[model samples]
Target: MAAIVWQTPANPPEPEDYIFFKGKRYVRPYYFEFISHVKNRWAGKTIVDLFTEEFRGRPYEYYESAVKSGRIQVDDKIVSVSYIVRSTQKISHFVHRHEPPVLAGNVSILHSEPDVITVCKPASIPVHPCGQYRKNTIVGILQAEHGVAPLFPIHRLDRLVSGLLIFARNAGKAEQFRQQVTRPYCYYKSDDVI
Candidate 1:
């Protein structure tokens, strides 16, 4: 197994992560490369069909246009949309991503330890990548701001909820924490209920 590396914030958040305007937070549009490998189940399927079936984020016409424009590639080379995929073949999709604006709240670190880190998650930002949010999330902000990577969230908070969140530094710690939290009588209390 590979050794896990723990990172902490060493610099400020990246300028490209967001733009603060009129008290609103908006993430700047950026390009992202979505890379994947063909699985055994996908073998013999057309590239366009595979994309259309597996990824519903874009329309079939968009995938066709991307394939033709070389925005989508197979094994580092552009291929036709009708090209048949083979097992273990590499596929790349380069897309321009735009995340929606979120609340101009900060994700503040509350505590840190060798195996765990705690933070005060702000509202309007998802804990991780979901739906249309990829970069405008707590994980993304922590990575861009603090340089922490490969984080394993022990629990999650809703996008509209603000509260303390815990993250494990490594997979083992995450699993251990999960086991503890999943035990019977391991309950949570909200401040509002107090």
Candidate 2:
């Protein structure tokens, strides 16, 4: 005879947001979670099928848009609406909670060319939205404060560190930087050992 292992659902994130700028500690809301009890429940089923048939209530269109916007994740990784599940897996839905921090000082835009834009990002401002950060990110700041939109970031810097960052205005401009720019830069801290 085989033994069965009991399992419990994941604890939902609290109403208050948790964040860690440098270390790996952050908490974000989980709108909902679904753990397949049966191994074959998701076999040969599309991502939308599981949401519509199993977790039905709202229209299928809702789930479709949610998946498209990266609100759905299969086994901790965001997946598309057309993704297929082969076996029992955990699905998590994340909801964006708009609780961004406010910074009084203005971010400096070093340069703004037709193809790219360079800005001096402040410390504690995230380059993009993730975990507990949303409207407080560099991209968000540019839109709300400087009125720059549809900017594609070429590279990223740590949220806890302030430095110059570059962003490409379009995909073609991004490719140009990737092909033409080839310079080696070193980042080292003198503590004790290399």
Candidate 3:
């Protein structure tokens, strides 16, 4: 058997293993910034306008509360929703933190090789972090259980689907796998094609 170089930490942090967040909790803040490029493009635009443009799905009242709570800032200074923005300025926003739903299940490692690994992903586990899913994902499970790191998934299965999934251990292997899957294979020689 191959030697186990690393194992799950004896006392893994609560809710997850990775330390990508500050609080060591599953929930983390959402932060982003957009620098003004075109002059006067955002001259009359209010903070609410920019946030609404960025998050069209959210109701206007959501941003209203965010501005009131000082969660949104302009160049690090808390501003109201109606605060007008200027060109060449920086606008930043941080939303309230919330934890992603914890998926309860197991992931079976079907096969492993030097360059790739095959696993049977459980149902309801997302392939990657997005929206309310940060930890409690396939990648998180691999890190928390197995010692896999820097994993590159060659393909993805829906969050609700369970099936065999392949992951490349490195970038080179991932690129090679991508090329092989994307290009059509010709069994015959070039001369055989009419």
Q: Return the top candidate by TM-score.
A: 1
TM-score of 3: 0.66
Candidate 1 is scored at a TM of 0.83
Clashing pairs in 1: 9-146
Q: What is the C-alpha lDDT profile of model 1 across 16-61, one tens digit per residue?
A: 7688887668887766667789999999999999999899978999
Instruction: Provide the TM-score for each candidate, comma-separated.
Output: 0.83, 0.47, 0.66
Candidate 1: deviation at residue 52, Å? 1.3
Q: Give candidate 1's whole-model lDDT.
A: 0.84
lDDT of 3 by residue, 1-194 (tens): 96422221132223333334442223233222323342465667887876687568687788878778866667778887789888777655554334464445567889999999999997777887656564567876786678776679999999889999999999999999999999986777676943
Q: Give the poorly placed runs of model 2, Cα more than 4 Å off.
A: 1-103, 182-194
Higher-TM-score candidate of 2 and 3: 3
Question: Between candidates 1 and 2, which one is better according to lDDT?
Answer: 1
CA error at residue 163 for candidate 3, angstroms: 0.6
Enumerate clash totals for all models, in the order shown: 1, 0, 0
Which wins on lDDT, candidate 2 or candidate 3?
3
The lowest-lDDT stretch of 10 consecutive residues in candidate 1 is 4-13
In order, what lDDT does every prediction score? 0.84, 0.67, 0.68
